[model samples]
Target: MTAIEQGTAGGTLNATTARLDRLGDAVIVIAYIISVALYLRIMAQYMVGFFIPGGSPIWEPVIACASVALIIAIGIFRGFTGLDRLDRISLAAVLVLTTVLGAVLLIHDGTLVTSSTLRLPPPPPVGTLDALLILGGLVITVQGFETVRFLGDEYDAVTRVRASRVAQLVATSIYIGFVLVATPVMGLGTAAGPDSTLLNITARIAPWLALPLVISAVLSQFSAAIADTAAARGNLTGLSSWFSGPRPYLISGAAAIAIAATIPTLVLVTIASRAFAAYYAVEAVIAFRTTSGVLRKCGFALLAVLLLAITLFAQPAS
Candidate 1:
């Protein structure tokens, strides 16, 4: 969707992101549902393990539920303005942490880099199911960037284009920088855990940075999830007027988060990442099938299959 929106000619179709059909929207909703579930669950766990120490264990549920609920309530009551506030808060945390960490890495560690694969249990033979699943998890790590596409034409065309470019560049740079510094300092083991990556690394190098980074991660995930939840909810309601009311969405959203948070989950990072990859594949297929030209349609269909194939080697999370 982002690729199409950003003027990437997809297959033979002059793909238009603006006129997404119901089916495309529905599949996109599923991708968001699973992605947000994985994000919320991991974030809640991070908070429980780090910030809310020495309290009655009951506090775990409260913290987790409250964090998810608080954002939902904000989204419902405050709408776009509330989301903006959440985005700002999260961004502030990100800016501060990135600046300090980048400076620290350069000064304290000097030039260094390490492969996250260093400490990994030897991955199953390449092309195995385990390897694919692991690679999927790695893909999920950078999935948040696609959320930018949702911003759409909210700004003037040129402004949106420039802004998106700048944002992606900044995001890629920071992520690469952080990984370079963090992998060398903490190794693959620290980041591969179920806990938040920032929380784990900061705990070692900058204890003082831990609290704010965790808060930032939790808030960021919650905010993004709520936004995704609302998108999913809108699609559901659109499917049938019988699914009307904010009540239904609120209940379902909470239930999904709770289930995702408490259950003995699988390789969620892998699951969510592949789900998005699948979502993209589906969109491409839709584009191919809908295109007016037979040649373009076949080209897109082939491209779609190729994209799906590449998921087999996406470089799994460590």
Candidate 2:
């Protein structure tokens, strides 16, 4: 009687776990679709800004056309290696320019201990949903490292794990360094919009920097968009054997165009943040279930709760 009771409880628990895993898988697929759409929208907007000096009359239509072209191009590409190389080159160029600008700013003032120029700004008030959302939106900035998990065909599990760790470390270092270098100029841009803010900031330091900034933006965004598209394709294929060849990419592209037509680019960004937060929350839950140590389980549970809050409450930037 005792053995039968134990077996019945174990079977029930296993059934519950399986159902949860299936739900998590569905959520992840939806998140990946959102990610692909957001990436394409961003890349299209940046490309339009780079090529067209003044804004076009039909802005969203122009973005849609550009996104369609980009989708086609990504479909034609055979692999990520070339795209990765180009992305690295563009990133290196931008880093060099940022470093140079920072060095120039420091040297311009003769007094190293200047009072007004070098002071860090006071921390902004954060006791509100708006502030929390703003900070949560930053999760997008640290996003690309997880792409390794979608590249199973190209890399083994061990290699993907190792690569993801290295990618996260490198990306975090770069983000921190870039922020530090640009701290002085952060407050300089007044009239610049989202797409041109970095360009305007760079122009203030050195007018010649604008050309490289635009080129870097174009290259890096395009590469990143392609990466996201590929990841979405892989995810869809994993989710369903029926999703193969160009079918998944086509569906993603259509969804992206529909989203671009309906949603503002800024709102699209917030939506992406919410999607990624939900995805990560599900992953955290899975991690909590799979891990053995109490500390690890507690940590994952805490992370899942925080991510779920971001998903539910994070708002679009004003």
Candidate 3:
């Protein structure tokens, strides 16, 4: 979608199509901003949960506000490249940690037992619509790859395509492998909620792994949020003169902090998913019009309708 928009024949589409494309761009930019904020909120939760266990709810809000302030300040003074090195290092650490987490759980399969401190809850029966809603909500989990589309300035088209493919393959493999390996030990964690399950599971299998896991989680989230914020700013500034300065960053940061203080993480997850769904639905329409093959156009049309449904009906996990 981004490639089509940034193509050489810019705005050559009919005026109505061009208008819709711009509208999609605006939606995408806004959605990315919210996603960055939500990432910071989740990162703040990790910090509080690890460093100040059982801390007051007020602490998450305070930390989130401070984090956004730091992001905005660094963005204004140092630029997005300031954190490039750290982001790379943390991203590598995350990949390594995910590998180790899965391997360790697989190796310790025989020793795993039901949690004594926090019992795993039973799954409730879900109907078809409810299941679809949950699946839609989880679409955000498979994000980040699309961000590669916006990195054309840093990487050539071929490089971006390969990177996107490799990212999806690597991340999806890790997710699937981790899920398969950790199935037996799912009941071993002593978590207060879903967000802290990985940390608790880490502690259960290898006590020594807990601290590094938290550190990696913290760094990865912070760096990802940084990347998203920069992406949002770049897209917004490019789209309109009104967002050409620090206004985009400032406004989005404020909105994120406010949302962090008020909304539950689960709710934020669903909202973020819907926001991105809207963006994708719009992009699907753009693709539908631009492509040549009848079959391909039909596929895009179906995708647009499906994503539109998700945007409207997706629900957070129970």
| The candidate that achieves the highest lDDT relative to the unseen native structure | 3
Compose the digit string of candidate 2's lDDT tens values, residues 157-186.
678779888878877776776676555565
Tens-place lDDT per residue, model 3, 1-318, is 444645536745566667777887788777877777677777878777777866558887778778888888777776667655556777888877767767777777644443234334455599888988899997777777777666656777778788889988988887788777766566554445433366666776788888878777777788787777777777777678998667877877777777777887778888889999998899889888878899999999999999999999999986
Model 2 has an lDDT value of: 0.65
Better of 1 and 3 by TM-score: 3
* TM-score for all models, in order of appearance: 0.70, 0.79, 0.88
lDDT string for model 1 (1-318, tens) is 434544433454343443444555566667676665766776676677685653334554455556666656775777556766766777677687667767775554553323222332333356666575465556666655444445542444556567657877887888888766655455434444532355665676668877776776676666667656665665566556776656535755666666565643345666666667766666677677556688888888887776576454444454
- The candidates, ranked best first by lDDT, are 3, 2, 1
lDDT of every model, 2 decimals: 0.61, 0.65, 0.76
Report the error of model 1 at residue 107, Å. 2.3
lDDT of 2 at 305: 99
Clash statistics: count for each candidate? 5, 0, 0
| Alpha carbon RMSD to native, model 1 | 6.3
